[model samples]
Target: MWLTNARVFDATGAAARDGRAILIEDGLIAAEDQAGAVPDGVDVIDLAGRTVLPGLIDAHAHVFATPPTPDDGAEPLWPGLTAHFVATGLREALRMGFTTLRDVGSYGDEVITARQAMRYGAFPGPRLLTCGRIVSATAPGGRFFDGMYREADGPDEVRKAVREQVRRGADFVKVMSTGARSVELEDPHPAQLTGPEIAALVDEAHRLGYRVAAHAEGLAGTELAIRLGADTIEHGMYLNQRPDLLDEMAAAGQVLVPTLSCYYGVASGQWTAPLVRLARHNLAEASRTLLAARAAGVPIALGHDWQPFSDAAVELIRLVEHGMTTHEALLAATATGARALGLDDRLGTIQSGKVADLTVVDGDPLTDPVLLRDRAQIWLVLQRGAPVAGAVFDNSAAIAANARTAADSRSVTHTSALSNAGRPRSGTTETPG
Candidate 1:
C-alpha cells in the first residue's frame, strides 16, 4: 500500500514534508519516497495533501476507571457490562487515531483480558499495555478505588505486589507513591509509601524486566520517585516546586506524564468543594511543572487520564495551551509517549522498517492542535497498514444507494434511519465506530 500526495509530520519535531509518499508492505513501512515513485499495480491511496502522522499514543490511561455515583457509591454498571464498556473505549481510542494505549492502572486483570481479546481478533482495538493494578501502600485508597489498588505495607509486601502483577501478565508496574486527589478521605501531599517500599517495588519490577510508573502528585513523593529511578512519573504536578527533582528526572531519562486532563475533570466535576479547590490548585501547579520540565529537558508524554477515551487528543491541545509549542506537543503525544511505554524503537516515528501505524487528518495539526480532537478531521486511521477506523470507511456511495432504494420503495422510515445513522456525531459521543 502506498499513501501519496501527503504532508507528513513523521513525529520527529520537524516541519511537515509535503508531497511525500509512504510505502507499506507486510505491515511495515517499506520506504518514504516521492509521490511519483509508486510502482504500477500497487494499491495507491491518494491523500490529496492531507496531513499524515505517526499513530498517536496515550502513555497514561485507566481503561477500567468507572467513577462511582455520589448517591449510591456504586459504579454505573456491573462487571460484565463494564467489560463491554472497556472494549468500546478501546475501539473509540483507535477511531481517534490512537494506535497504542498504555494503561497505567486498572481493575484486576480486565485490561489484560481486553488486550488478549484484541490480539485474538475478538474485537478491533489499539495495542494495549497495562499494569494489572496499582501497587499502593495500605491506605484508604484501597477501599476508595476498590479493585484497582493492590495495597501492601512493608517493602516485602510491596515487592510481592509487583511480582503479582507480573504474574498476571502486566506489561509494567504502577506504584502510588502519594495518596490520590480523588479520594476524599486521603491526602494528595506527602509521600504515602516508605522509601524502602518504593525502592523494593521498583527493584522487583526492574528485576523482572518491566518499567515502573509512579503516581507522584506532591513534591515529596515526586522527589522520591525521581531519586528511586521510576521510569515514568504520573501527574508530577508539584515538580515545579523542586527544580532539583526536575534536573534529576532529566538526567535519569524519567518521563513525566503530567495528566492535566485528570485535574481538569476533578475541578469541573461535582465533587466536594475542598477537593475541587485542591484540583484547581493542582492544575495551576501542573501548568508550571510542565514548563519547568520542558526547560529542564525532561521528556513529557501525553496522558489524558479522563473518560470518553476518544477525546484523549485534547491532551495535545492542553499541552500547547500550557506553554508547549504545537510541535513539542505533537512529540509529547507521539515519540515521547512511545518512550514512556518503552516502544520507541518500533512505534513512535514514521520511519522505514517500523510498524505502519499511521493517522491521516484533513488539516495540519501543527497550525491548530485542536484539529486532533475533531473526529471529522480524522480522515483515516491505519493499524499495521490496515484501515481500522476512519471517515474514509463510511462508504457513502453504498449508503446513498441504499437510501435511494428505500426511497423508491416508499419506505420513508427506513431511509430516514439509515441516513441518520451514517451521519457522524459531535464530541466524545459514543458510536459504533
Candidate 2:
C-alpha cells in the first residue's frame, strides 16, 4: 500500500516533514521519501492533511480492569467475567490510536490468551505483553486480593513466584514493593518486600531474560526497588522528596512509568468528598515529583493505569503541564514507551524495515496537544500495515484472518531482553523538510 499527502512526524527526534510518501509491503515498512514514486497496481491511501506518527504505546496497562467504583472494594467485583472486560479495554485502546499495550498485572493468563488471539487474527487490538500476576507477600497482599496475587512469604517463595509467572509464559515479572494509597487497603508508605527478598526475585527474573516492574509509591519502597535494579518504576509519587535519588535513577537509566491520571481522577471529582480529601496530598506529590524527574533526566513513558482507555492520552498532557514540550510528550507515548517495553527496534519510529504501524490524527499535536485526548481527533490507525480502525477504513476482520493464518504457520517472538538508554530530547520545528 502507498500512503501519501500527509505530514510525517517520525518521532525519532527529527523535525516533521510535509508531503511524504510511505510504502508498506508484507506488513513491514518498505520505504519513505519526500516525493517517492509508487509501483503500479499497489493500493493508495490518501491521508488528506492529517499528521502521521508512530502508533502509541501504553507502558503500564490492565486489559481486564474497568473504571473503579468506590463501593467495589479490594476484590474482583464480577467473577468469571475477565475475558469480556479485557476484550472491551483492548478494542477501545486500539481505536484511540494505541497499537501497543504492556499489561503489567492481571489475575491470570487472560492477557496471554488475548495476546495470542490478537496475534492470530481472532480480533483487532494492540500488541500485548503481560506479567501474569503480581507477586506479593502473604501477610498484606494475599489476605486481601487473593484473585490478583500469588502470595508468598520469603525470599525463597518470592523467587518461586517469579518462576511461576515465567512458567505461565509471562513476558515480565511484576512485584508490589509497597502498599497502595488509592485503595486504602494496605500501608501505603512501608516496604512490603525486604531487600533480600526483592534481590532474590530480581535475580531470578533477570536470569530468565525477563524484566521486572515494581509498584513503588513511597520513598522507602522506590529506593529499595531502584537499588535492586528494577527495570521500570511504577507510581513513583515520592520521587521529588529525594532529588539525589532521582539523579541516581538517571545514572542507572531506570524508566519511570508515572500514572498521574490516577490522582487526577480523584481531583477531578470522579469520586465523592471522602475520597477527594484522601487523594489530594498524594496527587500533589505526584505532580511535583514528575516535574523533578523530567528535570533530572529520568526517562518518562506514558501509562494509563486503569480503565477509560482514552485517558491514556491524558498522561501526555500531564507531562506538558508538569514541564515537557509537546514533541517530548509525543515521544514519551511513542518511542520512549517502546523502549520501556523492549519493542523499540521493531515498533516505535516510522523508519524503513520496522513494522508498519502508524496513527493519523486530524490536527497538529505539536501546536495543540490536548487534541490527542479527544477520540474524535484520532482519524486512523494502521497495525502491521493493515487498517484496523479508522474513519476511512475498517479492515480489522480481514486483518484478523490473516493474523491467525500467520500465527499457525510460524513461531513469532514478541518479548525481548530488557535494556535502557540515556535521556533523549526532541528537535525544534524548522522549515518543513
Candidate achieving the largest lDDT: 1
Question: CA lDDT, every prediction?
Answer: 0.82, 0.77
CA shift of 410, model 2, Å: 34
lDDT of 1 by residue, 1-433 (tens): 7677889989876678999989888778999866774454445566764799999999988896353366857645655766777888888898899988998877766788888778767667778888888999888999988888999999999999999988888889999999887886788688989899999999999998999999988778777888998999999998898999899999989999999988888899678888899889999999999999999999999999865687899888889989999999999988999999988888889999888889899888889778888888887787777667776556634323322222133322222111244433212211110
Cα lDDT of model 2 by residue, 1-433, tens digit: 7777778888889988888888888878888887455455455555556789899989988776564456756564576566766777887888788988889877666787777666656667777788888988754566566567887778999999999998887888998888766554677677888889889989999998988999998778789999999989998988899998889889988889888877777867878787787668777888888889899999888888874786678888888887788888898899889888877888889999998888888878888887787777887777877666654333323222222111223332221111122110111001100
lDDT of 2: 0.77
Error of 2 at 285 (Å): 1.2
Off by over 4 Å in 2: 65-81, 270-274, 394-433
Q: Which stretches of candidate 1 lie over 4 Å from their true place?
A: 65-79, 396-433
Model 1 superposed RMSD (Cα): 7.4
